[model samples]
Target: MIRIENLRKTYGKIQALCGIDLHVPAGELFAYLGPNGAGKTTSIRILTGLTRLSAGAAALNGHDIAAQSTAAKRQCGLVPQHVNLDSELTVGENLDLHGRLFGMPAATRRQRIAELLAYVELGDRVHSLVKQLSGGLKRRVMIARALLHNPRILFLDEPTVGLDPAIRRRIWSLIKQIQQQGTTIFLTTHYIEEAEFLADRVAFLDSGRIVAVDSPTALMAGVGHWAVDWVSDAGLQSAYFPSREAAQAAGAARHNGFTLRRVNLEDAFLTLTGKKVATDANAQTVHGQGHGAHAAATRNPTGGQAKKGH
Candidate 1:
Protein backbone atom coordinates (compact mmCIF):
# COMPACT_ATOMS: atom_id res chain seq x y z
CA MET A 1 0.00 0.00 0.00
CA ILE A 2 1.20 3.50 -0.89
CA ARG A 3 -0.35 6.93 -0.30
CA ILE A 4 0.71 10.30 -1.67
CA GLU A 5 -1.12 13.56 -1.06
CA ASN A 6 -0.42 16.96 -2.51
CA LEU A 7 3.12 15.85 -3.25
CA ARG A 8 5.27 18.54 -4.77
CA LYS A 9 8.94 18.69 -5.79
CA THR A 10 10.92 21.54 -7.27
CA TYR A 11 14.43 22.30 -8.40
CA GLY A 12 15.12 26.00 -8.63
CA LYS A 13 12.30 27.24 -10.89
CA ILE A 14 11.60 23.80 -12.40
CA GLN A 15 8.82 21.87 -10.73
CA ALA A 16 9.16 18.14 -11.32
CA LEU A 17 6.05 17.14 -9.42
CA CYS A 18 3.09 19.47 -9.07
CA GLY A 19 0.98 18.40 -6.12
CA ILE A 20 -0.04 14.96 -7.38
CA ASP A 21 -2.36 12.84 -5.21
CA LEU A 22 -2.44 9.07 -5.57
CA HIS A 23 -3.30 6.03 -3.47
CA VAL A 24 -2.45 2.42 -4.32
CA PRO A 25 -4.28 -0.24 -2.34
CA ALA A 26 -2.56 -3.31 -0.95
CA GLY A 27 -1.84 -6.12 -3.44
CA GLU A 28 -2.55 -3.91 -6.44
CA LEU A 29 -0.36 -3.60 -9.53
CA PHE A 30 -0.45 0.13 -10.23
CA ALA A 31 1.24 1.69 -13.25
CA TYR A 32 2.26 5.34 -13.48
CA LEU A 33 2.36 6.19 -17.19
CA GLY A 34 3.93 9.28 -18.69
CA PRO A 35 6.45 10.50 -21.22
CA ASN A 36 9.84 11.69 -20.05
CA GLY A 37 9.92 14.90 -17.95
CA ALA A 38 6.46 14.06 -16.64
CA GLY A 39 7.55 13.50 -13.02
CA LYS A 40 7.15 9.73 -12.97
CA THR A 41 10.70 9.09 -11.81
CA THR A 42 10.59 12.10 -9.51
CA SER A 43 7.63 10.59 -7.72
CA ILE A 44 9.45 7.25 -7.37
CA ARG A 45 12.58 8.93 -6.04
CA ILE A 46 10.51 10.78 -3.46
CA LEU A 47 8.69 7.64 -2.36
CA THR A 48 11.92 5.64 -2.07
CA GLY A 49 13.67 8.41 -0.12
CA LEU A 50 16.22 8.98 -2.88
CA THR A 51 14.92 12.49 -3.54
CA ARG A 52 13.26 14.82 -1.05
CA LEU A 53 9.92 16.39 -1.88
CA SER A 54 9.49 20.14 -1.67
CA ALA A 55 6.09 19.88 -0.02
CA GLY A 56 3.27 17.49 0.95
CA ALA A 57 3.23 13.95 2.29
CA ALA A 58 3.87 10.35 1.22
CA ALA A 59 3.57 7.12 3.17
CA LEU A 60 4.47 3.49 2.58
CA ASN A 61 2.02 1.06 4.06
CA GLY A 62 1.03 3.25 7.04
CA HIS A 63 4.34 5.00 7.88
CA ASP A 64 5.01 8.54 6.74
CA ILE A 65 8.05 8.61 4.42
CA ALA A 66 9.48 11.80 5.89
CA ALA A 67 8.65 11.16 9.54
CA GLN A 68 9.24 7.40 9.57
CA SER A 69 11.80 7.04 6.84
CA THR A 70 13.18 3.78 8.12
CA ALA A 71 9.82 2.08 8.58
CA ALA A 72 8.48 3.45 5.32
CA LYS A 73 11.58 2.36 3.42
CA ARG A 74 11.51 -1.06 5.02
CA GLN A 75 8.22 -1.75 3.28
CA CYS A 76 9.51 -1.34 -0.28
CA GLY A 77 12.16 -2.57 -2.74
CA LEU A 78 13.23 -0.69 -5.86
CA VAL A 79 14.53 -1.81 -9.24
CA PRO A 80 15.79 1.33 -10.89
CA GLN A 81 15.50 2.04 -14.62
CA HIS A 82 19.15 1.42 -15.33
CA VAL A 83 21.15 -1.62 -14.28
CA ASN A 84 23.09 -0.64 -11.12
CA LEU A 85 24.68 -3.94 -10.20
CA ASP A 86 28.43 -4.24 -9.78
CA SER A 87 29.83 -5.74 -12.97
CA GLU A 88 32.79 -7.27 -11.16
CA LEU A 89 30.71 -9.30 -8.74
CA THR A 90 29.04 -12.63 -9.34
CA VAL A 91 25.28 -12.91 -9.28
CA GLY A 92 25.19 -14.53 -5.86
CA GLU A 93 27.75 -12.05 -4.53
CA ASN A 94 25.73 -9.06 -5.71
CA LEU A 95 22.58 -10.28 -3.99
CA ASP A 96 24.52 -11.20 -0.84
CA LEU A 97 25.81 -7.66 -0.51
CA HIS A 98 22.30 -6.25 -0.80
CA GLY A 99 21.07 -8.64 1.90
CA ARG A 100 23.90 -7.51 4.17
CA LEU A 101 23.05 -3.88 3.53
CA PHE A 102 19.58 -4.63 4.89
CA GLY A 103 21.29 -6.18 7.95
CA MET A 104 20.35 -9.77 7.21
CA PRO A 105 22.28 -12.45 9.05
CA ALA A 106 24.84 -14.40 7.00
CA ALA A 107 22.81 -17.61 7.00
CA THR A 108 19.65 -15.77 6.04
CA ARG A 109 21.51 -13.94 3.30
CA ARG A 110 22.80 -17.16 1.83
CA GLN A 111 19.39 -18.80 1.99
CA ARG A 112 17.65 -15.86 0.41
CA ILE A 113 20.25 -15.52 -2.28
CA ALA A 114 19.83 -19.16 -3.25
CA GLU A 115 16.05 -18.98 -3.11
CA LEU A 116 15.78 -15.77 -5.10
CA LEU A 117 18.28 -16.96 -7.70
CA ALA A 118 16.13 -20.02 -8.25
CA TYR A 119 12.97 -17.95 -8.17
CA VAL A 120 14.25 -15.69 -10.92
CA GLU A 121 15.51 -18.72 -12.87
CA LEU A 122 19.13 -17.76 -12.42
CA GLY A 123 20.17 -20.76 -10.34
CA ASP A 124 22.71 -21.85 -12.94
CA ARG A 125 24.17 -18.39 -13.37
CA VAL A 126 24.85 -17.63 -9.71
CA HIS A 127 28.58 -18.11 -10.15
CA SER A 128 28.81 -16.02 -13.32
CA LEU A 129 30.09 -12.46 -13.18
CA VAL A 130 27.43 -9.83 -13.68
CA LYS A 131 29.17 -8.47 -16.77
CA GLN A 132 29.09 -11.99 -18.19
CA LEU A 133 25.30 -12.12 -18.09
CA SER A 134 22.97 -10.88 -20.82
CA GLY A 135 20.86 -7.78 -20.31
CA GLY A 136 17.78 -9.88 -19.61
CA LEU A 137 19.69 -11.96 -17.07
CA LYS A 138 20.98 -8.82 -15.42
CA ARG A 139 17.45 -7.47 -15.13
CA ARG A 140 16.30 -10.70 -13.54
CA VAL A 141 19.18 -10.50 -11.08
CA MET A 142 18.15 -6.96 -10.18
CA ILE A 143 14.64 -8.15 -9.48
CA ALA A 144 16.02 -10.91 -7.24
CA ARG A 145 18.28 -8.50 -5.38
CA ALA A 146 15.40 -6.11 -4.80
CA LEU A 147 13.38 -8.97 -3.35
CA LEU A 148 16.29 -10.10 -1.20
CA HIS A 149 14.82 -8.32 1.81
CA ASN A 150 11.26 -9.49 1.14
CA PRO A 151 9.81 -5.99 1.18
CA ARG A 152 6.03 -5.90 0.96
CA ILE A 153 6.03 -3.41 -1.92
CA LEU A 154 8.18 -3.19 -5.08
CA PHE A 155 8.84 -0.03 -7.07
CA LEU A 156 9.90 -0.87 -10.63
CA ASP A 157 10.99 1.99 -12.88
CA GLU A 158 11.04 0.90 -16.53
CA PRO A 159 11.58 -2.72 -15.59
CA THR A 160 11.72 -3.88 -19.20
CA VAL A 161 13.46 -1.08 -21.03
CA GLY A 162 15.93 -2.03 -23.79
CA LEU A 163 15.12 -5.72 -23.71
CA ASP A 164 13.86 -7.50 -26.82
CA PRO A 165 10.18 -8.36 -27.05
CA ALA A 166 10.73 -12.02 -26.12
CA ILE A 167 12.77 -11.09 -23.07
CA ARG A 168 10.33 -8.35 -22.23
CA ARG A 169 7.54 -10.90 -22.22
CA ARG A 170 9.60 -13.07 -19.90
CA ILE A 171 10.05 -10.15 -17.53
CA TRP A 172 6.31 -9.49 -17.74
CA SER A 173 5.59 -13.02 -16.58
CA LEU A 174 8.03 -12.54 -13.70
CA ILE A 175 6.36 -9.27 -12.71
CA LYS A 176 2.95 -10.93 -12.82
CA GLN A 177 4.28 -13.78 -10.68
CA ILE A 178 5.50 -11.29 -8.10
CA GLN A 179 2.11 -9.56 -7.99
CA GLN A 180 0.27 -12.86 -7.66
CA GLN A 181 2.48 -13.61 -4.67
CA GLY A 182 0.91 -10.56 -2.93
CA THR A 183 3.45 -7.79 -3.33
CA THR A 184 1.92 -4.39 -3.96
CA ILE A 185 3.76 -3.15 -7.07
CA PHE A 186 4.19 0.48 -8.11
CA LEU A 187 5.50 0.61 -11.67
CA THR A 188 6.59 3.39 -14.08
CA THR A 189 7.29 2.51 -17.69
CA HIS A 190 7.52 3.97 -21.21
CA TYR A 191 5.98 0.85 -22.74
CA ILE A 192 2.24 1.49 -22.86
CA GLU A 193 1.43 -2.13 -23.76
CA GLU A 194 3.37 -3.36 -20.76
CA ALA A 195 1.17 -1.31 -18.46
CA GLU A 196 -1.96 -2.29 -20.36
CA PHE A 197 -1.12 -5.97 -20.01
CA LEU A 198 0.24 -5.97 -16.44
CA ALA A 199 -1.45 -3.27 -14.38
CA ASP A 200 -4.76 -3.45 -12.52
CA ARG A 201 -4.98 0.35 -12.53
CA VAL A 202 -2.92 3.07 -14.21
CA ALA A 203 -2.36 6.79 -13.69
CA PHE A 204 -1.61 9.07 -16.60
CA LEU A 205 0.80 11.84 -15.58
CA ASP A 206 1.68 14.70 -17.90
CA SER A 207 3.45 18.04 -17.48
CA GLY A 208 4.12 17.30 -13.79
CA ARG A 209 0.51 16.44 -12.95
CA ILE A 210 -1.79 13.42 -12.87
CA VAL A 211 -4.31 13.80 -15.69
CA ALA A 212 -6.26 10.60 -15.19
CA VAL A 213 -6.33 7.37 -13.13
CA ASP A 214 -8.40 4.32 -13.92
CA SER A 215 -8.31 0.74 -15.13
CA PRO A 216 -6.71 0.45 -18.58
CA THR A 217 -9.90 -1.04 -19.98
CA ALA A 218 -12.00 1.76 -18.54
CA LEU A 219 -9.69 4.41 -19.96
CA MET A 220 -9.70 2.72 -23.39
CA ALA A 221 -13.47 2.48 -23.23
CA GLY A 222 -13.66 6.20 -22.57
CA VAL A 223 -11.90 6.71 -25.93
CA GLY A 224 -14.00 4.03 -27.71
CA HIS A 225 -13.25 0.40 -28.74
CA TRP A 226 -12.09 0.80 -32.33
CA ALA A 227 -9.78 3.24 -34.08
CA VAL A 228 -9.58 4.33 -37.71
CA ASP A 229 -6.20 5.77 -38.63
CA TRP A 230 -5.59 7.88 -41.76
CA VAL A 231 -2.69 9.98 -42.96
CA SER A 232 -3.45 13.66 -43.44
CA ASP A 233 -1.68 16.97 -43.99
CA ALA A 234 -1.28 16.99 -40.20
CA GLY A 235 0.61 13.67 -40.49
CA LEU A 236 -1.31 10.75 -38.97
CA GLN A 237 -4.72 11.14 -37.33
CA SER A 238 -7.19 8.78 -35.72
CA ALA A 239 -10.90 8.57 -35.03
CA TYR A 240 -12.43 6.34 -32.36
CA PHE A 241 -15.75 4.53 -32.73
CA PRO A 242 -17.89 2.47 -30.36
CA SER A 243 -17.85 -0.61 -32.60
CA ARG A 244 -15.86 -2.23 -35.42
CA GLU A 245 -18.76 -1.64 -37.84
CA ALA A 246 -18.79 2.07 -37.09
CA ALA A 247 -15.01 2.22 -37.45
CA GLN A 248 -15.23 0.44 -40.82
CA ALA A 249 -17.91 2.80 -42.03
CA ALA A 250 -15.86 5.79 -40.98
CA GLY A 251 -12.78 4.40 -42.67
CA ALA A 252 -14.73 3.72 -45.88
CA ALA A 253 -15.86 7.35 -45.93
CA ARG A 254 -12.29 8.65 -45.67
CA HIS A 255 -10.95 10.16 -48.93
CA ASN A 256 -7.51 8.93 -48.00
CA GLY A 257 -6.55 5.35 -47.26
CA PHE A 258 -7.29 4.33 -43.67
CA THR A 259 -6.37 1.48 -41.30
CA LEU A 260 -8.69 0.01 -38.69
CA ARG A 261 -7.42 -1.26 -35.35
CA ARG A 262 -8.41 -1.65 -31.72
CA VAL A 263 -7.97 1.33 -29.43
CA ASN A 264 -5.15 0.91 -26.91
CA LEU A 265 -3.76 2.55 -23.78
CA GLU A 266 -1.60 4.93 -25.84
CA ASP A 267 -4.75 6.12 -27.61
CA ALA A 268 -6.31 6.89 -24.24
CA PHE A 269 -3.18 8.81 -23.18
CA LEU A 270 -3.01 10.68 -26.49
CA THR A 271 -6.70 11.57 -26.32
CA LEU A 272 -6.25 12.99 -22.82
CA THR A 273 -2.88 14.81 -23.13
CA GLY A 274 -2.35 15.19 -26.89
CA LYS A 275 1.02 13.53 -26.35
CA LYS A 276 2.29 10.04 -27.00
CA VAL A 277 3.58 8.06 -24.02
CA ALA A 278 6.63 6.93 -25.99
CA THR A 279 7.73 10.35 -27.12
CA ASP A 280 11.25 11.48 -26.19
CA ALA A 281 12.78 8.20 -25.08
CA ASN A 282 15.86 9.97 -23.78
CA ALA A 283 14.05 13.05 -22.56
CA GLN A 284 15.07 14.48 -19.21
CA THR A 285 13.19 16.24 -16.48
CA VAL A 286 12.69 19.97 -16.75
CA HIS A 287 15.72 20.29 -14.47
CA GLY A 288 17.73 18.29 -17.05
CA GLN A 289 18.57 15.35 -14.81
CA GLY A 290 18.67 11.75 -16.02
CA HIS A 291 18.36 8.31 -14.46
CA GLY A 292 22.14 8.09 -13.99
CA ALA A 293 21.91 10.52 -11.08
CA HIS A 294 19.01 8.65 -9.57
CA ALA A 295 20.91 5.37 -9.96
CA ALA A 296 23.78 6.82 -7.98
CA ALA A 297 21.36 8.10 -5.34
CA THR A 298 19.72 4.69 -4.95
CA ARG A 299 22.79 2.43 -5.07
CA ASN A 300 22.59 2.07 -1.35
CA PRO A 301 19.03 1.12 -0.67
CA THR A 302 19.12 1.96 3.05
CA GLY A 303 20.52 5.48 2.76
CA GLY A 304 22.31 7.62 0.20
CA GLN A 305 22.64 11.26 -0.70
CA ALA A 306 20.69 12.39 -3.76
CA LYS A 307 21.40 15.52 -5.73
CA LYS A 308 18.54 17.99 -5.95
CA GLY A 309 16.44 18.15 -9.17
CA HIS A 310 16.06 14.36 -9.52
Candidate 2:
Protein backbone atom coordinates (compact mmCIF):
# COMPACT_ATOMS: atom_id res chain seq x y z
CA MET A 1 0.00 0.00 0.00
CA ILE A 2 1.09 3.60 -0.58
CA ARG A 3 -0.10 6.90 0.95
CA ILE A 4 0.89 10.52 0.42
CA GLU A 5 -0.21 13.79 1.99
CA ASN A 6 0.60 17.30 0.74
CA LEU A 7 3.58 15.97 -1.19
CA ARG A 8 5.69 18.83 -2.59
CA LYS A 9 9.05 18.95 -4.31
CA THR A 10 11.11 21.78 -5.80
CA TYR A 11 14.32 22.24 -7.70
CA GLY A 12 15.15 25.89 -7.09
CA LYS A 13 12.64 27.84 -9.21
CA ILE A 14 11.03 24.70 -10.65
CA GLN A 15 8.30 23.05 -8.63
CA ALA A 16 8.06 19.38 -9.57
CA LEU A 17 5.29 18.28 -7.19
CA CYS A 18 2.77 20.56 -5.54
CA GLY A 19 0.67 19.26 -2.67
CA ILE A 20 0.03 15.81 -4.18
CA ASP A 21 -2.19 13.56 -2.09
CA LEU A 22 -3.13 9.96 -2.97
CA HIS A 23 -3.67 6.50 -1.58
CA VAL A 24 -3.21 3.10 -3.24
CA PRO A 25 -4.56 0.10 -1.38
CA ALA A 26 -2.78 -3.23 -1.16
CA GLY A 27 -3.11 -5.49 -4.21
CA GLU A 28 -4.48 -2.61 -6.26
CA LEU A 29 -2.96 -1.34 -9.52
CA PHE A 30 -2.87 2.47 -9.53
CA ALA A 31 -1.84 4.38 -12.63
CA TYR A 32 -0.43 7.91 -12.55
CA LEU A 33 -1.16 9.64 -15.88
CA GLY A 34 0.51 12.83 -17.08
CA PRO A 35 2.56 14.37 -19.84
CA ASN A 36 6.25 15.30 -19.72
CA GLY A 37 7.22 17.49 -16.75
CA ALA A 38 3.83 16.71 -15.22
CA GLY A 39 5.53 15.31 -12.11
CA LYS A 40 5.06 11.58 -12.91
CA THR A 41 8.71 10.63 -12.63
CA THR A 42 9.38 13.27 -9.99
CA SER A 43 6.75 11.73 -7.76
CA ILE A 44 8.06 8.20 -8.39
CA ARG A 45 11.60 9.32 -7.53
CA ILE A 46 10.44 10.79 -4.25
CA LEU A 47 8.50 7.63 -3.35
CA THR A 48 11.47 5.38 -4.15
CA GLY A 49 13.89 7.63 -2.25
CA LEU A 50 15.75 8.40 -5.47
CA THR A 51 14.64 12.02 -5.04
CA ARG A 52 13.73 13.72 -1.79
CA LEU A 53 10.51 15.64 -1.21
CA SER A 54 10.60 19.29 -0.18
CA ALA A 55 7.61 19.14 2.16
CA GLY A 56 5.12 16.34 2.69
CA ALA A 57 4.65 12.93 4.21
CA ALA A 58 4.81 9.62 2.35
CA ALA A 59 4.58 6.06 3.54
CA LEU A 60 5.13 2.69 1.91
CA ASN A 61 3.07 -0.07 3.44
CA GLY A 62 3.21 0.94 7.12
CA HIS A 63 6.70 2.51 7.14
CA ASP A 64 7.29 6.26 6.99
CA ILE A 65 9.37 6.94 3.88
CA ALA A 66 11.32 9.82 5.44
CA ALA A 67 11.77 8.62 8.99
CA GLN A 68 12.18 4.95 8.07
CA SER A 69 13.96 5.11 4.74
CA THR A 70 15.41 1.60 4.80
CA ALA A 71 12.24 -0.19 5.85
CA ALA A 72 10.17 1.90 3.48
CA LYS A 73 12.47 1.17 0.56
CA ARG A 74 12.41 -2.51 1.37
CA GLN A 75 8.65 -2.44 0.96
CA CYS A 76 8.73 -1.61 -2.75
CA GLY A 77 10.44 -2.60 -6.02
CA LEU A 78 11.09 -0.18 -8.91
CA VAL A 79 11.32 -0.83 -12.64
CA PRO A 80 12.51 2.45 -14.09
CA GLN A 81 11.17 4.10 -17.24
CA HIS A 82 14.37 3.24 -19.09
CA VAL A 83 15.89 -0.21 -19.40
CA ASN A 84 18.70 -0.62 -16.87
CA LEU A 85 19.86 -4.20 -17.33
CA ASP A 86 23.57 -4.61 -18.02
CA SER A 87 23.98 -5.64 -21.66
CA GLU A 88 27.16 -7.57 -21.06
CA LEU A 89 25.62 -9.82 -18.45
CA THR A 90 23.47 -12.81 -19.25
CA VAL A 91 19.85 -12.91 -18.14
CA GLY A 92 20.70 -15.24 -15.27
CA GLU A 93 23.81 -13.28 -14.44
CA ASN A 94 21.87 -10.03 -14.14
CA LEU A 95 19.37 -11.52 -11.72
CA ASP A 96 22.07 -13.23 -9.68
CA LEU A 97 23.88 -9.96 -9.19
CA HIS A 98 20.69 -8.25 -8.02
CA GLY A 99 20.11 -11.01 -5.49
CA ARG A 100 23.65 -10.58 -4.18
CA LEU A 101 23.13 -6.87 -3.73
CA PHE A 102 20.06 -7.59 -1.62
CA GLY A 103 22.21 -9.87 0.56
CA MET A 104 20.18 -12.89 -0.45
CA PRO A 105 21.60 -16.28 0.47
CA ALA A 106 23.20 -18.26 -2.34
CA ALA A 107 20.58 -21.03 -2.16
CA THR A 108 17.76 -18.52 -1.91
CA ARG A 109 19.07 -16.59 -4.90
CA ARG A 110 19.21 -19.74 -7.01
CA GLN A 111 15.66 -20.71 -6.10
CA ARG A 112 14.28 -17.24 -6.70
CA ILE A 113 16.15 -16.90 -9.98
CA ALA A 114 14.69 -20.13 -11.27
CA GLU A 115 11.17 -19.24 -10.13
CA LEU A 116 11.27 -15.72 -11.60
CA LEU A 117 12.79 -16.80 -14.89
CA ALA A 118 9.86 -19.17 -15.34
CA TYR A 119 7.42 -16.55 -14.09
CA VAL A 120 8.60 -14.10 -16.75
CA GLU A 121 8.77 -17.00 -19.25
CA LEU A 122 12.45 -16.41 -19.89
CA GLY A 123 13.74 -19.74 -18.65
CA ASP A 124 15.47 -20.50 -21.93
CA ARG A 125 17.27 -17.17 -21.81
CA VAL A 126 18.92 -17.99 -18.53
CA HIS A 127 22.31 -18.19 -20.24
CA SER A 128 21.61 -15.69 -22.99
CA LEU A 129 23.43 -12.37 -22.68
CA VAL A 130 21.20 -9.37 -22.17
CA LYS A 131 22.52 -7.74 -25.35
CA GLN A 132 21.42 -10.77 -27.37
CA LEU A 133 17.85 -10.69 -26.07
CA SER A 134 15.02 -8.66 -27.56
CA GLY A 135 13.74 -5.46 -25.95
CA GLY A 136 10.75 -7.34 -24.51
CA LEU A 137 12.93 -10.02 -22.98
CA LYS A 138 15.19 -7.42 -21.45
CA ARG A 139 12.16 -5.77 -19.88
CA ARG A 140 11.07 -9.10 -18.41
CA VAL A 141 14.52 -9.36 -16.87
CA MET A 142 14.03 -5.94 -15.30
CA ILE A 143 10.79 -7.11 -13.70
CA ALA A 144 12.49 -10.25 -12.43
CA ARG A 145 15.27 -8.20 -10.91
CA ALA A 146 12.85 -5.76 -9.29
CA LEU A 147 10.91 -8.65 -7.71
CA LEU A 148 14.00 -10.43 -6.48
CA HIS A 149 13.38 -9.11 -2.99
CA ASN A 150 9.64 -9.91 -3.14
CA PRO A 151 8.68 -6.47 -1.89
CA ARG A 152 5.12 -5.68 -0.89
CA ILE A 153 4.74 -2.90 -3.49
CA LEU A 154 5.98 -2.32 -7.05
CA PHE A 155 6.72 1.08 -8.61
CA LEU A 156 6.68 0.91 -12.41
CA ASP A 157 7.52 4.23 -14.04
CA GLU A 158 6.66 3.91 -17.74
CA PRO A 159 7.13 0.18 -17.64
CA THR A 160 5.99 -0.42 -21.19
CA VAL A 161 7.61 2.61 -22.82
CA GLY A 162 9.31 2.15 -26.18
CA LEU A 163 8.09 -1.44 -26.75
CA ASP A 164 5.90 -2.52 -29.64
CA PRO A 165 2.23 -3.19 -28.90
CA ALA A 166 2.47 -6.99 -28.83
CA ILE A 167 5.40 -6.96 -26.45
CA ARG A 168 3.77 -4.26 -24.35
CA ARG A 169 0.75 -6.49 -23.81
CA ARG A 170 2.98 -9.31 -22.62
CA ILE A 171 4.40 -6.99 -19.98
CA TRP A 172 0.91 -5.87 -19.07
CA SER A 173 -0.14 -9.46 -18.48
CA LEU A 174 2.89 -9.98 -16.28
CA ILE A 175 2.02 -6.87 -14.28
CA LYS A 176 -1.51 -8.12 -13.83
CA GLN A 177 -0.19 -11.44 -12.58
CA ILE A 178 1.96 -9.62 -10.06
CA GLN A 179 -1.03 -7.67 -8.84
CA GLN A 180 -3.03 -10.89 -8.53
CA GLN A 181 -0.27 -12.13 -6.27
CA GLY A 182 -1.17 -9.26 -3.90
CA THR A 183 1.60 -6.73 -4.67
CA THR A 184 0.53 -3.11 -4.69
CA ILE A 185 1.50 -1.60 -8.06
CA PHE A 186 2.05 2.11 -8.69
CA LEU A 187 2.41 2.72 -12.39
CA THR A 188 3.12 5.84 -14.51
CA THR A 189 2.56 5.71 -18.23
CA HIS A 190 1.96 7.94 -21.28
CA TYR A 191 -0.10 5.32 -23.07
CA ILE A 192 -3.65 6.16 -22.05
CA GLU A 193 -5.09 2.75 -22.88
CA GLU A 194 -2.39 1.00 -20.93
CA ALA A 195 -3.67 2.76 -17.84
CA GLU A 196 -7.27 1.91 -18.70
CA PHE A 197 -6.52 -1.75 -19.23
CA LEU A 198 -4.15 -2.25 -16.30
CA ALA A 199 -5.11 0.24 -13.61
CA ASP A 200 -7.89 -0.18 -11.10
CA ARG A 201 -7.83 3.58 -10.62
CA VAL A 202 -6.22 6.40 -12.59
CA ALA A 203 -4.90 9.79 -11.43
CA PHE A 204 -4.23 12.75 -13.71
CA LEU A 205 -1.59 15.24 -12.69
CA ASP A 206 -0.65 18.53 -14.36
CA SER A 207 1.94 21.21 -13.57
CA GLY A 208 3.04 19.17 -10.57
CA ARG A 209 -0.45 18.92 -9.11
CA ILE A 210 -3.05 16.17 -9.09
CA VAL A 211 -6.15 17.39 -10.91
CA ALA A 212 -8.32 14.28 -10.76
CA VAL A 213 -8.29 10.67 -9.55
CA ASP A 214 -10.82 7.89 -10.06
CA SER A 215 -11.56 4.67 -11.87
CA PRO A 216 -10.95 4.92 -15.61
CA THR A 217 -14.63 4.27 -16.25
CA ALA A 218 -15.77 6.98 -13.85
CA LEU A 219 -13.32 9.51 -15.27
CA MET A 220 -14.36 8.78 -18.85
CA ALA A 221 -18.03 8.93 -17.85
CA GLY A 222 -17.44 12.34 -16.29
CA VAL A 223 -16.67 13.65 -19.78
CA GLY A 224 -19.19 11.61 -21.79
CA HIS A 225 -19.70 8.29 -23.54
CA TRP A 226 -18.92 9.35 -27.10
CA ALA A 227 -16.46 11.71 -28.81
CA VAL A 228 -16.75 13.38 -32.22
CA ASP A 229 -13.51 14.49 -33.83
CA TRP A 230 -13.08 16.69 -36.91
CA VAL A 231 -10.90 19.37 -38.45
CA SER A 232 -11.67 22.89 -37.35
CA ASP A 233 -10.17 26.39 -37.72
CA ALA A 234 -7.97 25.56 -34.75
CA GLY A 235 -6.92 22.29 -36.40
CA LEU A 236 -8.21 19.03 -34.85
CA GLN A 237 -11.16 19.52 -32.53
CA SER A 238 -13.26 17.02 -30.57
CA ALA A 239 -16.61 17.18 -28.86
CA TYR A 240 -17.97 14.86 -26.16
CA PHE A 241 -21.53 13.59 -26.00
CA PRO A 242 -23.47 11.36 -23.64
CA SER A 243 -24.91 9.16 -26.40
CA ARG A 244 -23.83 7.64 -29.70
CA GLU A 245 -26.82 9.31 -31.42
CA ALA A 246 -25.55 12.71 -30.32
CA ALA A 247 -22.05 12.01 -31.60
CA GLN A 248 -23.43 10.55 -34.83
CA ALA A 249 -25.58 13.62 -35.36
CA ALA A 250 -22.54 15.88 -34.90
CA GLY A 251 -20.46 13.71 -37.25
CA ALA A 252 -23.09 13.99 -40.02
CA ALA A 253 -22.69 17.78 -40.02
CA ARG A 254 -18.85 17.73 -39.83
CA HIS A 255 -16.33 17.87 -42.65
CA ASN A 256 -13.66 15.32 -43.55
CA GLY A 257 -11.71 13.48 -40.81
CA PHE A 258 -14.82 13.28 -38.72
CA THR A 259 -14.88 10.25 -36.40
CA LEU A 260 -17.38 9.08 -33.82
CA ARG A 261 -15.89 6.89 -31.12
CA ARG A 262 -16.20 6.01 -27.46
CA VAL A 263 -14.60 8.51 -25.13
CA ASN A 264 -11.43 7.17 -23.47
CA LEU A 265 -9.25 7.90 -20.48
CA GLU A 266 -7.22 10.21 -22.73
CA ASP A 267 -10.35 12.26 -23.26
CA ALA A 268 -10.76 12.49 -19.53
CA PHE A 269 -7.12 13.53 -19.12
CA LEU A 270 -7.35 16.09 -21.92
CA THR A 271 -10.54 17.48 -20.41
CA LEU A 272 -8.88 17.87 -17.02
CA THR A 273 -5.38 18.95 -18.12
CA GLY A 274 -5.76 20.42 -21.65
CA LYS A 275 -2.73 18.38 -22.79
CA LYS A 276 -2.44 15.09 -24.63
CA VAL A 277 -0.64 11.98 -23.52
CA ALA A 278 2.93 11.65 -24.93
CA THR A 279 2.76 9.70 -28.19
CA ASP A 280 3.09 10.12 -31.94
CA ALA A 281 0.12 7.79 -32.36
CA ASN A 282 -3.30 9.28 -31.56
CA ALA A 283 -4.56 7.88 -28.27
CA GLN A 284 -8.18 8.38 -29.37
CA THR A 285 -8.16 6.36 -32.61
CA VAL A 286 -7.95 2.95 -30.94
CA HIS A 287 -8.18 1.17 -27.61
CA GLY A 288 -4.63 -0.22 -27.41
CA GLN A 289 -2.35 2.47 -28.82
CA GLY A 290 1.19 2.49 -27.42
CA HIS A 291 3.52 5.54 -27.30
CA GLY A 292 6.80 3.80 -28.28
CA ALA A 293 9.82 6.15 -27.92
CA HIS A 294 7.45 9.09 -27.48
CA ALA A 295 6.78 7.56 -24.07
CA ALA A 296 10.27 7.44 -22.46
CA ALA A 297 13.99 7.40 -23.25
CA THR A 298 15.30 3.90 -24.00
CA ARG A 299 18.78 4.60 -22.75
CA ASN A 300 20.97 7.29 -21.20
CA PRO A 301 23.25 9.62 -23.17
CA THR A 302 26.09 7.17 -22.71
CA GLY A 303 24.37 4.80 -25.18
CA GLY A 304 24.23 2.13 -22.53
CA GLN A 305 21.66 0.87 -20.08
CA ALA A 306 21.61 3.05 -16.95
CA LYS A 307 21.73 1.62 -13.42
CA LYS A 308 18.64 1.29 -11.18
CA GLY A 309 18.30 -0.58 -7.92
CA HIS A 310 17.71 -0.28 -4.19
TM-score of each: 0.89, 0.90
Q: Tell me the lDDT of model 2 at 15.
A: 91
lDDT by candidate, in order shown: 0.86, 0.84
- Candidate 1 to truth, TM: 0.89
Q: How many backbone clashes does candidate 1 have?
A: 0
Q: Runs in model 1 with CA error above 4 Å?
A: 280-310
Model 2 agreement with the true structure over 46-139: per-residue lDDT tens digits: 9999998999999999899999998998898899988889899889999999898777899999999999999999988899989998888888
Query: In candidate 1, what residue range of length 10 has the lowest lDDT sum?
Result: 282-291
Native-referenced Cα lDDT, model 1:
0.86
- True-vs-predicted CA distance for residue 110, candidate 2, Å: 0.6
Model 2's TM-score against the true structure: 0.90
* Residue 73's lDDT in candidate 1: 86
